[model samples]
Target: MEEIFENRGLGLGLSFSGLNGIVTYYDYNLDDNQQLHYSLELTGQQVGNSFKALRLTEESTDMQSISKSGSGNSLEIDRILVSGTYRWFVDESLVWGISEGLFYGAGGGFGYSTLKYQGERYKYGSQHIR
Candidate 1:
C-alpha cells in the first residue's frame, strides 16, 4: 500500500517541507528603497528512501539512485532542513524584485526544499510606486 501526507505552517508565505509535511517561510522589506530584504522560504517534501536521498551506500550495493516503498504504520524518517534567502529590488519598494538563495547542511533523515513568496503583486513606475 501507499500513502501521502501534507501540512501547512502558519506564516506569511507558502512553504513546503516534509518527510511527510509541507512548510514555507517569508520575510518582508525593511527600508524605503526596498533594495534590501530579509526574505526567506522553504519547500518540498521527504518521501521514498532515505539512503538514496542522502547518497548512502553499502559495500554490497553499488552507488545508485534510491527509491523504495513499504507497508507499515510509521514513516518515522525525518527530513529536516533550514534555508536562507536574500532579495533585491529590480525596482524599489519591493514591488518589483528578484531573489536568490541556498539550502545547505541538509542530510539523512532529511530532504530538499525550495522557497517562494506569494500574495504580493508587482507594481511599476518610479514616483507612482508604493
Candidate 2:
C-alpha cells in the first residue's frame, strides 16, 4: 500500500535572570491505502539553574485503519498525553577542591494519558516526587 507522511513544527525561546524558557508546537499527518493518522504536540520548558527546572508537554493523536481484503473492517483510535516535570539543582563544595561547580539534583514528574478506541475509553495517570 502507498503511504505518505508529513510533519511541521515551530519553536521559540527566551532567557532572563538565569531562567530560560522554550515553547514548541508540532503538527503531523499520515495517509496510507488503509490507514490515516494525524497528530499535534505542544511542549514547553523553563530552566533556571542546573539544579532547578520545569517541563511541560502535551500531545494528541488520531488514527484510522481499515482492512482492505478482510471484511472491510475499520478501526479508529484517539489518544492524548500530558506530562510535567520539576527538577532541583544541588551544589556541593569541598575544601580539597576536588568537587567544584558540580551540578547534581533529584526530581520527579507526573503524566496522564487517555485513549479512545472502538468506542471504548481508557485513562491512566502517575505522579512522583524525590
Candidate 3:
C-alpha cells in the first residue's frame, strides 16, 4: 500500500492540489497450486477554475482460472482515477477556461526488458465544460 500528495504553485502561491492511493497484493497456494492477485488505485485533484468542476471514476475486474494441477485459481483487478478542470487565472480568485481541450498520451510495455511482447497502447480523451 502507498499514498501520495502533490501540489503545484506559481510565484510562491499554491495553484493546485492532488492526492492518490494505491494497493497491491499477490497470493499463492502451495497445496493447490492456485494463485490470487489483488490491486486498488484511486486519485483526486483540484484545480483553480471558475466553473468549479470535479470528476470521479472507478473500475473493477475479476478473473478465475484452473491451474495445471487441477486446482481453482482466481485473480482480481481494480483501479480508480479522477481529474479536475484546469483553471486559467486572469487575476486573484478570477479564472478563465475554454469549452474544450485536446489530450494525447502514449504507453508501452515489454517482457522482462527484452522487448519480447512489444505491446503498445495509446489514449486520447477530451472534456467539455458548461
Best by TM-score: 1
Candidate 1 local lDDT, 12-105, one digit each (tens): 4433222223344544444422322222322222422333354443433212112222331221333335444444334333233233222122
Best by lDDT: 1
TM-score, one value per model: 0.28, 0.22, 0.17
lDDT of each: 0.33, 0.30, 0.25
Worst 10 residues of 1 by lDDT: 100-109
lDDT at 42, model 2: 23
lDDT of 1 at 108: 26
Which is the better candidate, 2 or 3, if ranked by TM-score?
Answer: 2
State how far residue 49 of model 2 sits from its true place (Å): 40
In Å, residue 105's CA in model 2 sits off its true spot by 8.6
Evaluated at residue 39, the lDDT of candidate 2 is 26
* Model 3 quality (TM-score): 0.17
